[model samples]
Target chain A: MTGSAAAALQVEGLWKSFGPLDVLQGIDLEVAEHEVIALIGASGSGKSTLLRCINLLETIDEGRIFIEGEEITAKGVNVDRIRRRVGIVFQSFNLFPHMRVIDNVTLGPRKVLKRPASDAEADAMRLLERFGLAEKAGQLPDRLSGGQQQRVAIVRALAMQPDLLLLDEVTSALDPELVAEVLNVIRELAAGGMTMLIATHEMGFARDIANRVCFLDAGRILEQGPPAQIFAEPREARTRQFLTRIIEAGRL
Target chain B: MTAQGGPDATSRGGPASLPGSRAQRRRDERTSALRSTLVAFLSTFVVFGVLVYIVVNSPGWPAVQASFFAPDIFWSSLPGIVAAFLVNIQLFLISEVLILALALVLAVARSSTAPVLFPVRLMATVYVDIFRALPGVLVIYILGFGIPGLNLPGVPTDPFLYAIVALTLIYSAYVSEVYRAGIASIHPSQTAAARSLGLSQPQALRYVVLPQAIRRVVPPLLNDFIGLQKDTVLVSYIGVVEIFRQSQIVEAGTFNFTPYLATALVFLVVTIPLARFTDWLVARQARRGGGASGAASQVASALGRSRGGQAAP
Candidate 1:
């Protein structure tokens, strides 16, 4: 058993269901500070649901989730405060279509953290510059290319100075040529020790960036180990089958 | 040009038409357009001319004309009716402000998802239902007369106040529904995105949801505004001396309905431009492919400019 006391994120026996279909069932995972964990799974394998539950974006049917050793899922916990420390980048690049890239980045800092607009904007500009998106600061999300928008979404999340980040299939929606740019941004974040929980279909990139790779199937984490072990010699049969399918599809 | 398709398709030039043929086709198209325009003009002229002929020949035409279209009475009553229209303008303007504010409150209440606010949502829903189900004039009469009859000391007995209140209440119910629909039209993903950013529910609604929702509903809100403007005439029943009431007084005194026609003219003059403006806004929104984005982009640019200004120093 992992030490939940010092973990950056700890989910214990988390269960979530939408109607009769159980999206997550008794899922337990723990990530140490500065750890980057990659969730690998098929389309309906509860990866997104697990990420959403950890972010408190989705209400869990049964579970206790802790972040930075605090019981975040406890009753009367202020979700806004919890979420302020945990940022999420959605698969759809759900950057506010109405807001410019800079505004999107600065929104959390200004509204949630109570940072002054100028300060938030200056920080956001610096982040955008780092992502090579400084020129797109004033453009709307729709005006950006898919990869640029996703990178802006990452920037937006990072601007909150979140202790933990949840990335849900961040590159799945991008065209092949556009995927590299978004992956590069993730690589930079991981290298800088941002402690991300990423659900991705990008096997090669996940193997490259993740400290540990977890295989989720049937709403549970079936296998987890160092990326080299999991990717090369997954122990569980389902994990082997999933890896075979991925390899057959030329994804790994 | 080579035409290899069908027998009937040979007459019209193909896509490979020479420059001369293309110019000829353009001239032909212009000629056809002009011909269609002339045909439409002549047909409209004929149709209206026959109707005028029948009306002019009718035995009651002279009497009807004198009663409703008397030139001298119309010209004399125009100034009075126009003056009274200022009262309508005030009533609607005041009522419009109240309606907008109240309707937004009601819409937010209805759209809220908190379990504790169930009673507030219920009350807002009931208020909308009751006001919408009741006729505008009935509400006006009930409030205008009924409130005063209650002998409520704080209540102003002025019918003008009731006119504004009644119109505000009735239109607020309708405008709230428009707002609710706008709120519903915005995808839940937007709320998720905002909430995930640590924004509280109210903040999300205020900053993200309401801005987009209100922009989406602007054209519809203007539609309700037009309805409220016309319904201001209904307040005359409660004894407000608006345009309709002034026209009625003139009609009663002169024993002719020409002043009513003058009132109609006033309405047409005022309402038509507003209606057309609404259409223009709707067209612009449609051309931009969605509500909120065009206005949102304008807002974005404005923010960019302001941010640029702030960043300069």
Candidate 2:
């Protein structure tokens, strides 16, 4: 395949499996620089696994993933280095439960990047302040609300200034009232031209922020296009059924 | 809760309990109180108090008192017992530090997944299983006497050093299990998050996992340490004159046993504080995790008052 300057991430014939289960099958995607790509799927359609494969968190059974023209799946690709560049935030907001919020955000910078404590903390504080969480700097993750914790997870990833961000259903675990706080953070990141691949169940947020949407079904991309087309004029019947359920549930 | 323990509906203390009828509540409380009193009386006074009375009032009482509880002998022997106790304390302190360091290393190695650490993990696991099954006193006897008996070139035969080494090896096996439990108890997501941020496996364990694991296991680790403290008397069997040894020597020479009783009292004096400290730590952790707010709220209120006291100039 030709290298495209506009593409920040490119996946070629990606496949993943877990023993007897085929989770991601023949997934090919190209995310242009500064683009927000939202993956919309039913519960077991391999959306999250696809994002994980891109970050090399879940190893692929076959195929390759390229980040900014460099193949991350090749042998001796330095997985930790690739993981540093493509940071991921889980739905559970897996913050280091023992550390204070500022410490959690600064840990990566200080340990991996070998930044001085003072410099790392300054960077962490800047990210926290941007997310309106400056007062919680000294508090542990359990002390914060679900939404606040999710936002802190984002700040932790952003502290590294990664080339790409993989957000896995980041707001799915939050209460309805708390979901906006987390979604607003993502909106601001998208507005600031952060290249993010998000797997989400929030159809409205997908429409609002995503430049493109991929609708996955049973381990394959059934339909994908600009969010306007995928949401309003889905080409596949499975996509239509998913949107209809979301609409009836008053979530669309 | 107390006032609502009445049995009849109209006879209940007040609106405090609107669910259970007063008659039922009173019956429950009465039965509970009766069972509690019966247990307290049987377990405490009848079983223990009666035995003590029989022993104290027996015809052999005077001879036993002369042998074991003669106050004059206890007072006279105190200086020697006190001197010997200092040796036990020194052994305990030295072995405690060494055991903690060795246990932490074993725990980390046991928990590692890297193929390079496979043999170390197997060795640590096998070591813990074997030594935990081996009787601690037997370990002391074999090493305590065997090392000195060997009398190898360049090897020290000091009983103090042997005692310390034997205790460390035995206790490290137990303490390492506590550390491993602590490390395993930490959720895997913590490591996932750390590694996602680019920390290597060791870096992840050091910066994120161990601090939490160590904090959680402090109470249990202290329990093991206190066991080590009590086990110091076993060193006397190896010919180091700790408190038990000094007390026994006095008993043999003077034909009185008060020094032995004094040694028992001293052991209690040391052990009780450690037991209490461990209880406090476990309770503090529970309160911090928001369990048992009855105790936790009291702490919070006390803390509030202290801060207010400071702010009042």
Candidate 3:
């Protein structure tokens, strides 16, 4: 546990573009060990793109991503090794529909980590129980509700015991009633000191649960600070406008 | 009041008995008669054409009874028919296994972004294009004779083996397209999810994408198998002793065409079940809400319904 003092993730001047469109333009951020950082942005603001780059799903055009203080941008960085240290969840649950819940959870550990099947399943079941999804272990993802499927996805990632978890609007696809269930799971994770960077639209969750809140606009980080300061005392006009629009929509 | 109502009843009955009503009824009868006459004319034309064809090309009733219905010819050709049947089953089994395995590799390779994947993409494109564009007869010939000195040792250079390999190659190309479409049809989010779980590219494909792709592609794969079953008859050209080739031999020896008709019957007997099975699979896929091709839309609709259902609860 003493090693937890190191920064869980560090990003510096990350730049990504697809042809003419610049998605993440010179973004810099760092996630401390066991800290929850909420990334708030409008559509096409590159918040999701930034999360993907952090996990190396979308290769950055130029930047350095370091995990445990080791730079991962250089050639021959063994990307798979870096990926093992980070886990991500999508807006859509993206559960493997053909696989049973437990198999979905254990696949990475069994295949990537080379753990024995028995050990993988044991760990998977423990994570499933933590997410309150133990009863649905034998069922395929299609058989579960959206909220339950998202939770299973979280458990699937957690089964890897990743050092950092990236959640990109994990509850965006769920029903209004189901959103609370998934958020509760995330809240529980945060409470247990799991380092997380969540790109979310749930203003209340972002404001209350995140240790630090970062506002993204047009592929750049516009403002970032502790949630109490960022939400209650906005520094930039753009940040103020963004928060006001979200608050108005939440009331509707 | 009852006396006043009696006049209203009389007026109502008068409308049904009027001369204008009778005229309208006659017009309706004439229209119905004309419609029936037109339908009868079309039906009679179809039935008459079929009857005339049968009468003209009957091959003589006495000859048919003697050649087909007689026990001698039917029983004598049993061995040949059984041999052909066995070869057909073997051809399908071998070709299907090879095609499925190859198609998976081809599909995945084509989907990858690596520079090495270019050759795989090119090969898949070329293979599918050549086989699909060229006739099956041409493919069978190329495999049979085009590969100079390409005989397996101790295997006698059998045409049946050549035919099986040819069919496998041609069908593998077609099946690869089905697989590509199936794999492409999956929501990209699935791969993203697997990657997010720390799976390598190959691992994600092997454990996640391929399974879903195969499930969606099964019906079409069966359809391709049915097509392969029929095309096996084309192997008769290389003297493979398939059902059609055996029928040709029997026809030449007996100087009767009954064997050719018997070959047709045999083909129908084998392929009808396969076609029906494909139909059943398609119907089952349809019942799963018009197949898995529209997976994104299906997911969205399912999410919408769940949201609505939850609201009521």
lDDT (Cα, tens digit) per residue for candidate 1, span B87-152: 999998999999999999999999998999999999999999999999887899999999999997
Name model 2 segments beyond 4 Å from true.
Answer: A1-3, B1-49, B290-313
Better TM-score candidate (2, 3): 2
Screening candidate 1 with a backbone cut-off below 3 angstroms (N, C-alpha, C), the clashing residue pairs are none
Docking class for candidate 1 = medium
| Candidate 2 chain A, poorest ten consecutive residues by summed lDDT | A1-10
Which pairs of residues collide in candidate 3?
none
Model 2 per-residue lDDT at A191? 97
Count of clashes, each model:
0, 7, 0
Candidate 1 vs candidate 2, TM-score winner:
1
Give the C-alpha lDDT of model 1: 0.89
The number of residue pairs in model 3 that clash at the backbone is 0
User: Which of the numbered candidates is closest to the native, going by highest lDDT?
Assistant: 1
lDDT of 2 at B242: 96
Cα error of candidate 2 at position B9, Å: 20
lDDT of 1 by residue, A211-250 (tens): 9999999899999999999988889999999999999999
- Which CAPRI quality tier does the interface of model 2 achieve? acceptable
DockQ (model 3, Cα): 0.24
Candidate 1 reaches a DockQ of 0.54
Show what share of the native A-B interface contacts model 1 retains: 0.52
Cα-based lDDT for every prediction: 0.89, 0.86, 0.80
